[model samples]
Target: MQIITASQALMPEGWQSDVEIRIAADGRIAEVGPMTTRAAHHLDMLLPAPLNLHSHAFQRAIAGLTEARGPDPADTFWTWRQQMYRFLDRLDADQVEAITAMVFMEMLEAGYGAVAEFHYLHHAAQGQPHDDPAEMSARIIAAAQIAGIGLTLLPVLYQWGGCDRRVLAGGQRRFGTDPDSFARLHAGATRHLRDHGHADDRLGVAPHSLRAVDAEGLDAALALCPESPVHMHLAEQVAEVEEVMAHHGARPVTWLLDTHDVDARWCLIHCTQMTPQETARLAATGAVAGLCPITESNLGDGIFDGVRYLGANGRAGIGSDSNVHIALFDELRTLEYSQRLRDRSRAALATPTAPTGRRLFEMALAGGAQAGGRDAGRIEAGAWADLLGIATDNAWLCDRHGDAALDTAIFGGHGQACISDVWSAGRHVVQEGRHIHRDAIRARFRAAMTALEATV
Candidate 1:
């Protein structure tokens, strides 16, 4: 068991002072009340850490490599995807594990206690499966274990190249798997996690997108994981919406809602192209809109309709999709800033009772836990002990209290520097703004990047 005391902590009802949290042997919060005795760990300000609902961990390796202008005058998500594919062709399992470990460690330092990896890189360079079909999935689970970050291993089902059902070519070959093969792969991955993963680890399913999986394939993937979290890329780009419309006779979200029962278990990534009606309809379904503001902006994808969606009582959470940047505060601030820039207003997401920063933080906490299917995002008994520690003495947080402290952490510059500690399911993996295994992770990542740079 582990004991932690906080000068202030965000409980389910609201902020509490002089709070104590107890972690059971199973890593769940065992108790939450006033601090009466000394504890092994102490925090100045504590908040429930949010899960990153969508991530392609290997893409962290290509962060700065795709910034230059390609032959196209207007570089778009498609062009960036081509570069990403080319880079992944040179990656092996060891390199992928190293890169993923670095990404997970960075996420912990950034205050994300857990991640739902939308993993699709399944095959080898030449599109051949390894002896164990789920070798790549095992590596991802292993990396999560090494980083001590809660894992939601989403084995992605990527079958076709487009809505036309074309064969996957080039770097896309690594992600190709039919429904039958994907079932085997999913089972293999499940066995690995059951045998090797931590108690908080989870398994989820992701159909790459409407374009990549036909109706029959999507049904098969859904059948493989009946009750687990179901995530998918939905209407991220204009071209994608158009393609889905041209092929399916309706927009992505519209067609999806009409065809499938998209309830709370579903997390739709990047509803950036949704109409107002589609937004309202999706919101009513209780599905989470997984927003990756930085990656959306970096890829030239249009801004999501946050005001309308939230006003309709939608669920939303943030993710570092491309991992071009991995700062939690930046993600939250960028989300609000995008809404502000779109509407020419300030505090666009603020409510009557909650400030902008507080509202966004709480929404993310709820939506992330729902999307990842983790029993977390609250400081209460029976919840996973995923917590973020903030140092009130930092210059960015000086003299701040209550919601003002959260506002400063989100809006103030150098917010990452204010992060003092992080716990994922009672594992204190990050301390003093650094991951506990930072040096080793950094060294391995550096070696992997050096070799990858030489090749690509």
Candidate 2:
């Protein structure tokens, strides 16, 4: 058992002062109430850290490498994707683990308790299966274990090159797998998670996108993991929406809603191109819209219609899709700012009862937990003890208290310097604004990057 007293803590009811939180040996919150003299740790401000609903861990290594303008006059998502493929073509198992560990550590330090990784990179550089078909997946799982971050591992299914079902080509070969092969891979990976992963860790399936997997492929993938959470990239680009309409006779989300049983278990990564009608209809479903505003902005993907979606009571969560910027508050700030730019308004995501920062944070906690299939996102008795301790001594937080501190953390900050400590599954992984294993993880990651820089 562990006891921690907080000067102020954000509870389900509201912000409370002189709060004490108790954690059970099993890593779940045991009790929470007024402070007691017997305390093991203390915090100035505490907030329940949310899971990152989507990520591509390997992409961390190439975050800033794709910023240069391409030969084409019009550089777009397609061009960025080509650069991504080329970068991944030279990645090996060791480098994958190193890069992933660094990214996962950053996620924890930046106030994310967990990550739902959309892992699609599989096989060797030459497109051959490794000795263990799930070799790459094992590396990802291992990295999470090392970082002490809760993980929802979604082994992605990518079969084709486009919506027309063209055969996998070039760098795409490394991510492609037939249904039979994918079934075996998924089974092995799920078993590994069940046996080796932490109690809160989960396994799920991701159909890469509408462009990569046909209806039949998606059906098979869903059938293989009937009860698992399902994630897919949808309508991230105008070309993708247009291509899906051309090939499937309807927009991607439209077809999925018409055909599949998408519910709370489904999380669509990007619906940036959805019509207002599609937005309202999708909001009616309990499924979450996984928004990665930083990466969306980086790739020039259009802003999500947050005003309409949130007004319609839509569920949503944030993710560091490209791992370019892993700051949780930055993701929240970027999300709200994008809406302000699109709607010509301020405080666009705010609710009547709460400020914009509080509203977005609470909604993300709930929606991300739902998407991750984890018993978390609350500082309640049964939830996992994943908490973020904000440093009150920070200049931005000096005069702030309660929700005002959160507002500054999200909107007034450039990074996560205000997040002084982070606990994942009751384990103190980050303290004093850094991960516990930062020195070692950084050394390994730097070595891996140095080696890959010469090759890729």
Candidate 3:
């Protein structure tokens, strides 16, 4: 049992002062209330860190490597994917593990207590299954364990090359698997999680995308995990939307909702090209729009219809997709700023009463916990003790308090520097604005990158 006191803490209702939190032996929050007295482990401010609803862990390795323009006049998301495939072609399990650990550490330090890893890089460099079918997934699980971050392991099912159901092509072979093969892979990943005593770790099914999975394949994969959270890359690009429309005679989001029983259990990443009707319809389904603003901007993907979606009472969360930048505040700030730029207005994500920062932070916390299938995102009883202690000393947050503190943190404070400490399920994974294993993880990642660079 452990007790923590904070001068101020963000609760579900609102900010509370002189807050006390009791962490249970099993890492769940047992109780919370006013402190009995001035506790020693006192913090200036505390907030429940949000979960990252979508991430491609291995992509962290190639962050700044894909910025160069090629011979194509129109550099696009499709071209970026080609670069990604080329980069991953040489990645092995150990390198993947190192890079993933580094990413998870960064996530924790950046005020994300948990991550939903959309893992899809299966098989070997030449697209052959390793001796242990779950070898690569084991690497991810191991990395997450070492980093001490809550993980929702999403085993992806990728089969076809596109909406046309073309056979897996070069640079895409490693991610291909038939329904039966994918089922086995998913089951194997689950067993590994259980055997490692991470029984509470979620196992979700990802059908990759509408373009990658046919209706039959999607149905089969969803059937394999009925209750687990389902995530997919939705209308992220204009080309993808057009392709799905050409093949299915409906927009990607339209075809998906009409075909599947999507609900609160589903999270659609990057609805950047959704029509207004599609946005409203998707919002009505209680599914989360897993927005990765930094990545969308990096790839020049169009902005999501935030005003319209929020007007329809949509659920949404932030993700560190592509991991070019991993700061949670940056993701939220980028999301709000994107809408602001589009509408030519200030505070585009603001509600009537709540400020933009508080509103975005609260919505992402709730929606992200729902999407990740984690018992977190709140400093309340029964939630995991995934808390972040915000440093009051940050020059940008000097005179702020309550919601204003959140505003400064999100909009003005330096990335991760505003976060003083972080607890992941009661483990003090980050302190003094650094992960406990930051140096080791960074060193391993540096070595891995060095070796990879020599090859590439």
Best by lDDT: 1
Query: What lDDT tens digits, residue by residue, belong to model 3 across residues 1-456?
Result: 888899999998898999999999888899999999877678889899899999998998889998899879899988899999898788989999999999999999999988999998988986888887777888989999989998899989998999888998776888989999998888889888888635346778899999999999999999998998999999999988899999999999999889878999999999999888898999999999999999999999989999999889999999998999888999999999999998899999898899999999998999999999988999999989989998787577895789888888889847468788898888889988888899999999999999999998
lDDT on C-alpha atoms for all candidate structures: 0.94, 0.90, 0.90
Candidate 3 segments exceeding 4 Å error: 197-199
**Two-way lDDT contest, 1 vs 2, winner:** 1
Model 1 per-residue lDDT at 10 = 89
Task: Give the alpha carbon lDDT tens digit for every residue of 1-456 in model 2.
Answer: 988888899999999988999989888999998996736678889999899999999999998899999999999999998998888778889999999999999999889999999998889986889878888889999999999999999999999999878998778889999788999899889877887788889998999998999878899999987887899998899999999999989998898899987899999997999999999989999899999999999999998998999899999998999998788998899999998888899998888789998999998899899989888999999899999888877677784788888898888884388888888889889988889999999999999999999986
* Alpha-carbon lDDT of model 1: 0.94
- Residue-pair clashes per candidate: 0, 0, 0
Please report, as a residue range, the 10-residue window in candidate 1 with the lowest summed lDDT: 393-402
What's the TM for model 1?
A: 0.99
Residue-wise C-alpha lDDT for candidate 1, range 413-438, written one tens digit per residue: 67788999999999999988889999
Kindly report the root-mean-square deviation of model 2 from the true structure over all alpha carbons.
1.1
